[model samples]
Target: MNYLDRKYQATMSVHQLSILLQYSNQDVFQLGNFVPLTALSLPTIIRAAKALVETGFLISNEKDLTELSVLTLNTSFNSKRINVKVALPQSSKPQEKEAEATCNTLMQDRKYYMECTIVRIMKARKVMKHNLLVEEVLKQTQSRFFPDVQFIKKNIEALIDKLYIQRTDQNDEYEYIS
Candidate 1:
């Protein structure tokens, strides 16, 4: 008897049966030709047992009925294994779209603020006294939309360190180095 023939009397859909077997929560049943039906629910055990019996792989005795059964493999076995397919469920939350919109808005706001500050600094550079003081720069840069003097000072220092602007004498009361 072939593996399929010995395991099943009828031509069962190996793929479907394999899937059902794989997901079954019970642990008493083992894979391969012989599998126990005791771990399965009554309906499933009955159906599976009936299927096996119909396929000629199993025989039930009149006495000592058992929920589990064992199958004998035949030498004519040809199939290696069966494959079961399952699909993944989709996500229900729309967080990705919301996050994207928030990120875009923040980026646009940052770009507008940076552009305004750059323009203000450039305009101030032209008329700034030859001796430019940090205080003077801070005052000139201050605006209703951007009043954080400390933040402005830190940004200017970073720009100087990066060579975008030059800083001369740190001790000088007033100086220019761009």
Candidate 2:
């Protein structure tokens, strides 16, 4: 007796719809009027009535109905199958992956910029103190981004690893390799 039952969706039983329609009889009637006619609970009948209201089978005095809410059959409405197309939302996983890749690329570019600044400063000075070199690198890279001293120090170590510079006997200074 299920009228419009679909998998994973709500439905109104045909018997419940018919009882409500038969009782309306071209005049407004309260939902409670059908409670005594059917073995179903009053709340169950109300739910069916609400489903019918959504399908244009019934017109109600209130959009949100209660047991005392008045309803009338929508006699003018033609009973026809409606084709509803629901559009599913796009997945966010791809977007999250793309954002993560972009962030990693930006970090790599920042690291490159810091290393370049270190090499450029060392090449120009030939020899410089560690703290002074760090300050100069910060000054040169500030127009693009403000790099921390720890990050500058890491880049300096990378330059030393690449043979672009070397730590002096002073231990607090660096000497350009070329």
Candidate 3:
């Protein structure tokens, strides 16, 4: 295993190196393999390759002007022991996408108020059909502003996820939990 100076790590960020480590399968890898699998540029890839060579982590077989040559990892290097934090692109992460899809996607105050109206209505009417429930929730909250059926639907799904309400044996019917 190579013990690279942390200062050498500055040549390319740990995240970039981690990316290289991720797609590299065998000891000797062709240059094109990484370009399709990762966002690393030619310069960064060359730099990382050089740094790994300097650290004794990899052995470069060839270096060409137009394209990179094969490179090999040291036998002692283990990916699990790399211990570098790889940062994912912000928008690509599942949590961020989910939040964008639901939480931040809705108008908070309006969503909260609409959810309350739904609970209040469902409390009064224990069981309601899906279409009717949507209709009723919309009808009740109509005074505030017309809520999109889809937005109302998203809130209902969120409520169901929270266990505040559940769908009954009948397809469209929903019953309040409390």
TM-score of each: 0.27, 0.50, 0.41
Candidate ranking under TM-score, highest first, comes to 2, 3, 1
Question: Which window of 10 residues has the lowest lDDT sum in candidate 3?
Answer: 1-10
The list of candidate 1 runs beyond 4 A from truth reads: 1-112, 115-144, 170-178
As a whole number from 0 to 100, the lDDT of residue 16 in candidate 2 is 51
lDDT of 3 by residue, 1-178 (tens): 2343332222346635754575345666766566665677765565555555555556566644124577666665444344533332232466677777786556788889988998898889988888988888878888988989999899999999989899999878899998
User: What lDDT would candidate 3 get against the real structure?
Assistant: 0.68
Per-residue lDDT of model 1, residues 28-64, tens digit only:
3322323342343443344554454344334444222
Name model 2 segments beyond 4 Å from true.
1-90
Task: Give lDDT per model, in order.
Answer: 0.43, 0.74, 0.68
Q: Across residues 1-178, which tens digit of lDDT does each residue of candidate 2 receive?
A: 1233432232446655455546544456788877776666775676677777776656886987788899886656543344422222234786799899999999899999888888888889999999899889878889998988888888888889999999889999999998
Number of the top-ranking candidate, with TM-score as the measure: 2
